[model samples]
Target: MGKEFIEIFEKWADTYDSSLTKDIEYKEVFRGYDQILDSVANKAFGEVVEFGPGTGNLTVKLLELGLSVTGIEPSPAMRKLADEKLKGKAVVKDGDFLSFTVEKKPDVFVSTYAFHHLTDKEKAEAITLYSNLLSSSGKIVFADTMFRSEEEYEKAKAAASQSGFHNLAADLAREYYSTIPKLKGMLEENGFTATFTRLNEFVWIMEGIKLQ
Candidate 1:
Protein backbone atom coordinates (compact mmCIF):
# COMPACT_ATOMS: atom_id res chain seq x y z
CA MET A 1 0.00 0.00 0.00
CA GLY A 2 2.82 2.37 0.82
CA LYS A 3 4.56 1.93 -2.49
CA GLU A 4 1.31 2.10 -4.40
CA PHE A 5 0.28 5.26 -2.57
CA ILE A 6 3.69 6.74 -3.17
CA GLU A 7 3.32 6.13 -6.89
CA ILE A 8 -0.11 7.72 -6.84
CA PHE A 9 1.25 10.76 -5.02
CA GLU A 10 4.14 11.00 -7.45
CA LYS A 11 1.62 11.23 -10.26
CA TRP A 12 -0.27 13.93 -8.45
CA ALA A 13 2.67 15.99 -7.26
CA ASP A 14 2.60 18.78 -9.80
CA THR A 15 -1.16 19.21 -9.83
CA TYR A 16 -2.21 18.33 -6.29
CA ASP A 17 -2.14 21.85 -4.93
CA SER A 18 -4.23 23.13 -7.81
CA SER A 19 -6.74 20.32 -7.30
CA LEU A 20 -7.00 20.89 -3.55
CA THR A 21 -8.61 24.23 -3.79
CA LYS A 22 -10.79 23.48 -6.83
CA ASP A 23 -13.62 22.31 -4.66
CA ILE A 24 -15.06 24.56 -2.02
CA GLU A 25 -14.78 21.86 0.66
CA TYR A 26 -11.15 21.20 -0.11
CA LYS A 27 -10.41 24.89 -0.53
CA GLU A 28 -11.75 25.52 2.94
CA VAL A 29 -9.67 22.64 4.31
CA PHE A 30 -6.51 24.01 2.71
CA ARG A 31 -7.15 27.43 4.15
CA GLY A 32 -7.68 25.91 7.58
CA TYR A 33 -4.41 23.98 7.40
CA ASP A 34 -2.61 27.20 6.51
CA GLN A 35 -4.23 29.11 9.35
CA ILE A 36 -3.44 26.45 11.95
CA LEU A 37 0.19 26.26 10.92
CA ASP A 38 0.51 30.01 11.02
CA SER A 39 -1.00 30.08 14.51
CA VAL A 40 0.83 27.41 16.59
CA ALA A 41 4.28 26.81 15.12
CA ASN A 42 6.68 28.48 17.59
CA LYS A 43 10.03 26.65 17.49
CA ALA A 44 11.50 29.23 15.14
CA PHE A 45 15.16 28.28 15.22
CA GLY A 46 15.80 24.53 15.50
CA GLU A 47 14.90 22.10 12.78
CA VAL A 48 11.31 20.92 12.47
CA VAL A 49 10.06 17.68 10.95
CA GLU A 50 7.05 17.57 8.63
CA PHE A 51 5.39 14.39 7.43
CA GLY A 52 4.14 13.92 3.85
CA PRO A 53 4.41 17.47 2.71
CA GLY A 54 2.47 16.98 -0.54
CA THR A 55 3.53 20.29 -2.11
CA GLY A 56 5.17 22.49 0.54
CA ASN A 57 2.02 24.42 1.38
CA LEU A 58 2.60 24.01 5.09
CA THR A 59 6.36 23.93 4.62
CA VAL A 60 6.32 27.40 3.11
CA LYS A 61 4.25 28.65 6.04
CA LEU A 62 6.73 27.20 8.54
CA LEU A 63 9.55 28.89 6.67
CA GLU A 64 7.68 32.17 6.83
CA LEU A 65 7.54 31.68 10.59
CA GLY A 66 11.37 31.78 10.64
CA LEU A 67 11.92 28.04 11.05
CA SER A 68 14.07 25.67 9.03
CA VAL A 69 12.23 22.41 8.32
CA THR A 70 13.16 18.93 7.17
CA GLY A 71 10.29 17.48 5.16
CA ILE A 72 9.93 13.71 5.07
CA GLU A 73 8.05 12.51 2.02
CA PRO A 74 7.78 9.13 0.37
CA SER A 75 7.26 10.31 -3.20
CA PRO A 76 10.26 11.43 -5.21
CA ALA A 77 8.17 13.61 -7.46
CA MET A 78 6.57 15.30 -4.47
CA ARG A 79 10.02 15.81 -3.04
CA LYS A 80 11.05 17.52 -6.25
CA LEU A 81 8.02 19.78 -6.19
CA ALA A 82 8.54 20.57 -2.50
CA ASP A 83 12.13 21.45 -3.19
CA GLU A 84 11.04 23.69 -6.03
CA LYS A 85 8.27 25.21 -3.97
CA LEU A 86 10.53 25.81 -1.03
CA LYS A 87 13.83 26.11 -2.85
CA GLY A 88 16.63 27.57 -0.76
CA LYS A 89 14.36 27.26 2.25
CA ALA A 90 13.43 23.76 3.44
CA VAL A 91 15.40 20.55 3.29
CA VAL A 92 13.27 17.93 1.58
CA LYS A 93 14.03 14.32 2.46
CA ASP A 94 12.63 11.44 0.46
CA GLY A 95 11.26 9.01 3.04
CA ASP A 96 8.18 7.55 4.60
CA PHE A 97 7.01 8.74 7.97
CA LEU A 98 6.45 5.29 9.52
CA SER A 99 10.06 4.08 9.39
CA PHE A 100 11.84 7.31 8.51
CA THR A 101 14.53 8.14 11.11
CA VAL A 102 16.76 11.10 11.86
CA GLU A 103 19.84 11.44 14.06
CA LYS A 104 18.90 14.80 15.52
CA LYS A 105 15.62 15.07 17.40
CA PRO A 106 13.64 17.97 16.00
CA ASP A 107 12.48 20.86 18.12
CA VAL A 108 8.95 20.59 16.73
CA PHE A 109 7.04 18.01 14.65
CA VAL A 110 3.99 18.58 12.55
CA SER A 111 1.78 16.98 9.91
CA THR A 112 -1.15 18.44 8.05
CA TYR A 113 -3.81 16.54 6.07
CA ALA A 114 -1.36 13.66 6.01
CA PHE A 115 -1.77 11.60 9.21
CA HIS A 116 -4.86 9.84 7.89
CA HIS A 117 -2.63 8.06 5.36
CA LEU A 118 -1.32 5.78 8.11
CA THR A 119 -2.96 2.54 9.20
CA ASP A 120 -4.37 2.16 12.75
CA LYS A 121 -1.32 0.41 14.19
CA GLU A 122 1.06 2.65 12.27
CA LYS A 123 -0.60 5.76 13.65
CA ALA A 124 -0.22 4.44 17.20
CA GLU A 125 3.44 3.61 16.74
CA ALA A 126 4.06 6.93 15.01
CA ILE A 127 3.09 8.91 18.09
CA THR A 128 5.48 6.86 20.21
CA LEU A 129 8.27 7.48 17.74
CA TYR A 130 7.40 11.15 17.48
CA SER A 131 7.61 11.51 21.25
CA ASN A 132 11.13 10.08 21.18
CA LEU A 133 12.12 12.11 18.11
CA LEU A 134 11.08 15.36 19.72
CA SER A 135 13.38 17.19 22.07
CA SER A 136 12.15 17.78 25.62
CA SER A 137 9.23 20.22 25.73
CA GLY A 138 8.82 19.88 21.98
CA LYS A 139 5.40 20.52 20.49
CA ILE A 140 3.40 19.00 17.64
CA VAL A 141 0.66 20.53 15.56
CA PHE A 142 -1.49 17.69 14.20
CA ALA A 143 -4.04 18.94 11.72
CA ASP A 144 -6.10 16.19 10.22
CA THR A 145 -9.23 14.13 10.87
CA MET A 146 -11.29 13.33 13.99
CA PHE A 147 -13.87 10.74 15.06
CA ARG A 148 -17.01 11.59 13.19
CA SER A 149 -20.25 11.16 15.07
CA GLU A 150 -21.75 8.40 12.88
CA GLU A 151 -24.32 10.82 11.60
CA GLU A 152 -21.71 13.40 10.69
CA TYR A 153 -19.65 10.83 8.84
CA GLU A 154 -22.63 9.83 6.76
CA LYS A 155 -23.44 13.44 6.05
CA ALA A 156 -19.91 14.06 4.78
CA LYS A 157 -20.20 11.05 2.49
CA ALA A 158 -23.49 12.20 1.10
CA ALA A 159 -22.24 15.71 0.65
CA ALA A 160 -19.04 14.68 -1.08
CA SER A 161 -21.02 12.63 -3.54
CA GLN A 162 -23.30 15.53 -4.22
CA SER A 163 -20.47 17.95 -4.91
CA GLY A 164 -19.32 16.42 -8.22
CA PHE A 165 -15.76 16.16 -6.89
CA HIS A 166 -15.57 12.37 -6.84
CA ASN A 167 -12.35 11.48 -8.70
CA LEU A 168 -9.60 13.45 -6.99
CA ALA A 169 -9.51 11.19 -3.85
CA ALA A 170 -12.71 9.56 -2.72
CA ASP A 171 -11.75 6.36 -0.92
CA LEU A 172 -8.85 8.00 0.88
CA ALA A 173 -11.13 10.70 2.18
CA ARG A 174 -13.40 8.07 3.69
CA GLU A 175 -10.51 6.25 5.31
CA TYR A 176 -9.31 9.56 6.75
CA TYR A 177 -12.64 10.21 8.43
CA SER A 178 -12.18 7.21 10.73
CA THR A 179 -8.53 7.57 11.69
CA ILE A 180 -8.68 10.63 13.96
CA PRO A 181 -9.64 9.37 17.42
CA LYS A 182 -7.19 6.52 17.26
CA LEU A 183 -4.43 8.96 16.34
CA LYS A 184 -5.42 11.39 19.09
CA GLY A 185 -5.45 8.63 21.71
CA MET A 186 -2.14 7.37 20.40
CA LEU A 187 -0.55 10.77 21.08
CA GLU A 188 -1.92 10.87 24.63
CA GLU A 189 -0.92 7.27 25.33
CA ASN A 190 2.62 8.07 24.26
CA GLY A 191 2.71 10.68 27.06
CA PHE A 192 2.27 13.82 24.96
CA THR A 193 -0.52 15.91 26.37
CA ALA A 194 -2.88 16.45 23.43
CA THR A 195 -5.74 18.80 22.74
CA PHE A 196 -7.96 18.47 19.67
CA THR A 197 -9.74 21.39 18.09
CA ARG A 198 -12.22 21.27 15.24
CA LEU A 199 -11.09 23.62 12.53
CA ASN A 200 -13.68 23.35 9.75
CA GLU A 201 -15.88 20.34 9.03
CA PHE A 202 -14.09 16.96 9.11
CA VAL A 203 -10.52 18.25 9.19
CA TRP A 204 -9.57 18.48 12.90
CA ILE A 205 -6.51 20.11 14.42
CA MET A 206 -4.53 19.01 17.48
CA GLU A 207 -1.63 20.25 19.59
CA GLY A 208 0.67 17.98 21.60
CA ILE A 209 3.29 18.98 24.11
CA LYS A 210 5.99 16.51 25.15
CA LEU A 211 6.40 16.76 28.88
CA GLN A 212 9.71 17.44 30.56
Candidate 2:
Protein backbone atom coordinates (compact mmCIF):
# COMPACT_ATOMS: atom_id res chain seq x y z
CA MET A 1 0.00 0.00 0.00
CA GLY A 2 2.63 2.55 1.02
CA LYS A 3 5.44 0.92 -0.93
CA GLU A 4 5.21 3.91 -3.25
CA PHE A 5 6.82 5.92 -0.45
CA ILE A 6 9.74 3.55 -0.07
CA GLU A 7 12.19 5.99 -1.57
CA ILE A 8 11.05 8.65 0.85
CA PHE A 9 11.39 6.23 3.77
CA GLU A 10 14.83 5.22 2.56
CA LYS A 11 15.85 8.86 2.50
CA TRP A 12 14.16 9.57 5.80
CA ALA A 13 15.68 6.61 7.62
CA ASP A 14 18.64 8.40 9.17
CA THR A 15 16.72 11.55 10.03
CA TYR A 16 13.46 9.89 11.09
CA ASP A 17 14.27 9.84 14.79
CA SER A 18 15.56 13.40 14.65
CA SER A 19 12.44 14.58 12.91
CA LEU A 20 10.30 13.08 15.64
CA THR A 21 12.19 15.13 18.18
CA LYS A 22 12.47 18.38 16.19
CA ASP A 23 9.37 18.59 14.05
CA ILE A 24 6.78 20.74 15.77
CA GLU A 25 4.06 19.75 13.36
CA TYR A 26 4.47 16.11 14.31
CA LYS A 27 4.74 16.86 18.01
CA GLU A 28 1.09 16.21 18.59
CA VAL A 29 1.11 13.22 16.28
CA PHE A 30 3.81 11.52 18.30
CA ARG A 31 2.89 12.86 21.71
CA GLY A 32 3.39 10.15 24.30
CA TYR A 33 5.44 8.18 21.83
CA ASP A 34 6.84 5.82 24.43
CA GLN A 35 3.40 5.33 25.90
CA ILE A 36 2.03 4.45 22.50
CA LEU A 37 4.71 1.84 21.96
CA ASP A 38 4.22 0.44 25.44
CA SER A 39 0.48 0.18 24.91
CA VAL A 40 0.93 -1.86 21.74
CA ALA A 41 3.58 -4.11 23.28
CA ASN A 42 1.44 -4.66 26.34
CA LYS A 43 -1.53 -5.79 24.25
CA ALA A 44 0.55 -8.26 22.28
CA PHE A 45 1.44 -11.79 23.35
CA GLY A 46 3.13 -15.00 22.17
CA GLU A 47 4.79 -14.86 18.75
CA VAL A 48 4.11 -11.43 17.18
CA VAL A 49 4.31 -10.19 13.62
CA GLU A 50 4.91 -6.46 13.37
CA PHE A 51 4.35 -4.72 10.05
CA GLY A 52 6.21 -1.57 9.02
CA PRO A 53 8.50 -1.36 12.02
CA GLY A 54 10.21 1.69 10.59
CA THR A 55 13.21 1.86 12.95
CA GLY A 56 12.51 -0.92 15.46
CA ASN A 57 11.24 1.40 18.22
CA LEU A 58 8.21 -0.73 19.00
CA THR A 59 10.19 -3.89 18.29
CA VAL A 60 12.46 -3.06 21.21
CA LYS A 61 9.51 -2.58 23.49
CA LEU A 62 7.97 -5.89 22.40
CA LEU A 63 11.23 -7.69 23.08
CA GLU A 64 11.61 -6.03 26.47
CA LEU A 65 8.17 -7.34 27.33
CA GLY A 66 9.40 -10.87 26.57
CA LEU A 67 7.35 -11.07 23.37
CA SER A 68 9.08 -12.57 20.35
CA VAL A 69 8.78 -10.16 17.43
CA THR A 70 9.17 -10.71 13.70
CA GLY A 71 9.33 -7.36 11.99
CA ILE A 72 8.39 -6.81 8.36
CA GLU A 73 9.90 -3.71 6.82
CA PRO A 74 9.79 -2.92 3.14
CA SER A 75 12.53 -0.30 3.04
CA PRO A 76 16.03 -1.71 2.85
CA ALA A 77 17.57 1.31 4.50
CA MET A 78 15.01 1.19 7.26
CA ARG A 79 15.66 -2.51 7.76
CA LYS A 80 19.38 -1.88 8.07
CA LEU A 81 18.82 0.76 10.70
CA ALA A 82 16.38 -1.47 12.55
CA ASP A 83 18.81 -4.34 12.42
CA GLU A 84 21.59 -2.19 13.79
CA LYS A 85 19.39 -0.88 16.55
CA LEU A 86 17.97 -4.30 17.37
CA LYS A 87 21.40 -5.98 17.61
CA GLY A 88 20.06 -9.44 16.67
CA LYS A 89 17.43 -9.40 19.39
CA ALA A 90 14.72 -9.69 16.72
CA VAL A 91 14.65 -10.45 13.02
CA VAL A 92 13.49 -7.65 10.72
CA LYS A 93 13.14 -8.80 7.13
CA ASP A 94 11.92 -7.46 3.82
CA GLY A 95 8.13 -7.48 3.58
CA ASP A 96 4.99 -5.34 3.60
CA PHE A 97 1.34 -5.44 4.61
CA LEU A 98 0.09 -7.72 1.85
CA SER A 99 3.06 -10.03 1.32
CA PHE A 100 5.41 -11.69 3.76
CA THR A 101 6.52 -14.95 5.29
CA VAL A 102 6.64 -15.88 8.95
CA GLU A 103 8.05 -18.91 10.79
CA LYS A 104 5.16 -19.31 13.23
CA LYS A 105 1.51 -18.40 13.56
CA PRO A 106 1.46 -14.98 15.23
CA ASP A 107 -0.72 -14.42 18.26
CA VAL A 108 -0.91 -10.72 17.45
CA PHE A 109 -0.40 -8.62 14.34
CA VAL A 110 0.92 -5.18 15.31
CA SER A 111 1.92 -1.98 13.55
CA THR A 112 2.56 1.61 14.45
CA TYR A 113 2.20 4.80 12.41
CA ALA A 114 2.61 2.97 9.12
CA PHE A 115 -0.73 1.39 8.26
CA HIS A 116 -1.96 4.60 6.61
CA HIS A 117 -0.12 3.52 3.48
CA LEU A 118 -3.03 1.22 2.62
CA THR A 119 -6.20 2.54 1.10
CA ASP A 120 -9.51 1.59 2.67
CA LYS A 121 -10.09 -1.28 0.26
CA GLU A 122 -6.58 -2.54 0.81
CA LYS A 123 -7.06 -2.16 4.53
CA ALA A 124 -10.14 -4.37 4.33
CA GLU A 125 -8.25 -6.91 2.29
CA ALA A 126 -5.43 -6.96 4.79
CA ILE A 127 -7.83 -7.44 7.66
CA THR A 128 -9.49 -10.30 5.82
CA LEU A 129 -6.14 -11.90 5.20
CA TYR A 130 -5.13 -11.57 8.84
CA SER A 131 -8.44 -13.00 10.00
CA ASN A 132 -7.87 -16.01 7.80
CA LEU A 133 -4.30 -16.41 9.02
CA LEU A 134 -4.76 -15.99 12.74
CA SER A 135 -6.23 -18.61 15.04
CA SER A 136 -9.16 -18.03 17.37
CA SER A 137 -8.54 -15.27 19.96
CA GLY A 138 -5.66 -13.84 17.97
CA LYS A 139 -5.30 -10.04 18.04
CA ILE A 140 -4.50 -7.09 15.83
CA VAL A 141 -3.16 -3.92 17.45
CA PHE A 142 -2.23 -0.93 15.31
CA ALA A 143 -1.53 2.67 16.12
CA ASP A 144 -2.04 5.05 13.22
CA THR A 145 -3.64 8.25 12.09
CA MET A 146 -7.38 7.71 11.67
CA PHE A 147 -10.36 10.02 11.83
CA ARG A 148 -13.80 9.37 13.18
CA SER A 149 -15.60 10.64 10.09
CA GLU A 150 -15.10 12.15 6.66
CA GLU A 151 -15.95 15.60 7.98
CA GLU A 152 -13.24 15.37 10.61
CA TYR A 153 -10.80 14.19 7.99
CA GLU A 154 -11.61 17.19 5.87
CA LYS A 155 -11.31 19.53 8.81
CA ALA A 156 -7.90 18.10 9.67
CA LYS A 157 -6.66 18.73 6.13
CA ALA A 158 -8.08 22.21 6.16
CA ALA A 159 -6.56 22.99 9.51
CA ALA A 160 -3.17 21.79 8.41
CA SER A 161 -3.31 24.02 5.33
CA GLN A 162 -4.47 26.95 7.42
CA SER A 163 -1.64 26.44 9.84
CA GLY A 164 0.85 26.61 6.97
CA PHE A 165 1.79 22.95 7.33
CA HIS A 166 1.85 22.55 3.60
CA ASN A 167 3.66 19.24 3.57
CA LEU A 168 1.47 17.84 6.32
CA ALA A 169 -1.64 19.08 4.56
CA ALA A 170 -0.48 17.53 1.32
CA ASP A 171 0.23 14.28 3.13
CA LEU A 172 -3.23 14.33 4.66
CA ALA A 173 -4.71 14.72 1.20
CA ARG A 174 -2.48 12.17 -0.52
CA GLU A 175 -2.43 9.33 1.99
CA TYR A 176 -5.02 6.60 2.41
CA TYR A 177 -5.84 7.62 5.98
CA SER A 178 -9.12 6.01 7.01
CA THR A 179 -12.17 6.68 9.15
CA ILE A 180 -13.06 4.74 12.30
CA PRO A 181 -16.47 3.53 11.14
CA LYS A 182 -15.03 2.11 7.94
CA LEU A 183 -12.32 0.30 9.90
CA LYS A 184 -14.80 -1.03 12.45
CA GLY A 185 -17.02 -2.39 9.72
CA MET A 186 -14.09 -4.09 8.05
CA LEU A 187 -13.04 -5.79 11.30
CA GLU A 188 -16.58 -6.96 12.07
CA GLU A 189 -17.06 -8.29 8.55
CA ASN A 190 -13.85 -10.25 9.00
CA GLY A 191 -15.13 -11.82 12.25
CA PHE A 192 -13.36 -9.72 14.86
CA THR A 193 -14.60 -7.54 17.67
CA ALA A 194 -13.11 -4.12 17.13
CA THR A 195 -12.31 -1.33 19.58
CA PHE A 196 -10.37 1.92 19.28
CA THR A 197 -8.75 4.29 21.76
CA ARG A 198 -7.44 7.74 21.02
CA LEU A 199 -3.76 7.96 21.89
CA ASN A 200 -3.37 11.56 20.78
CA GLU A 201 -4.88 14.19 18.56
CA PHE A 202 -3.76 12.43 15.38
CA VAL A 203 -3.35 8.81 16.42
CA TRP A 204 -5.56 6.00 17.63
CA ILE A 205 -4.85 2.52 18.90
CA MET A 206 -7.08 -0.02 17.12
CA GLU A 207 -7.53 -3.44 18.65
CA GLY A 208 -9.38 -6.29 16.98
CA ILE A 209 -9.70 -9.62 18.73
CA LYS A 210 -10.60 -12.53 16.49
CA LEU A 211 -13.75 -14.37 17.49
CA GLN A 212 -13.68 -17.84 18.92
lDDT of 2 at 163: 92
TM-score of 1: 0.85
Best by TM-score: 2
- Report the C-alpha displacement of residue 181, candidate 1, in angstroms: 3.7
Residue-level lDDT tens digits of model 2 in 1-212: 47898988999999998888788777888899989999999999999999999899999999999999999999999999999999999999898999999999988999999999998888999999999898679999999999999999999999999998887899899889999999999999999999999999999999999999
- Number of the top-ranking candidate, with lDDT as the measure: 2
Off by over 4 Å in 2: none
Q: How many clashes in candidate 1?
A: 0
Candidate 1 residue lDDT tens string, 1-212: 14557767877787787776675646655665556666546433477888888788888878877777888898889888888888768787777767676667788878877776777777777778778888888877767755556566667667767877574248435454554555667778888887777777666777888888
Clashing residue pairs in candidate 2 are none
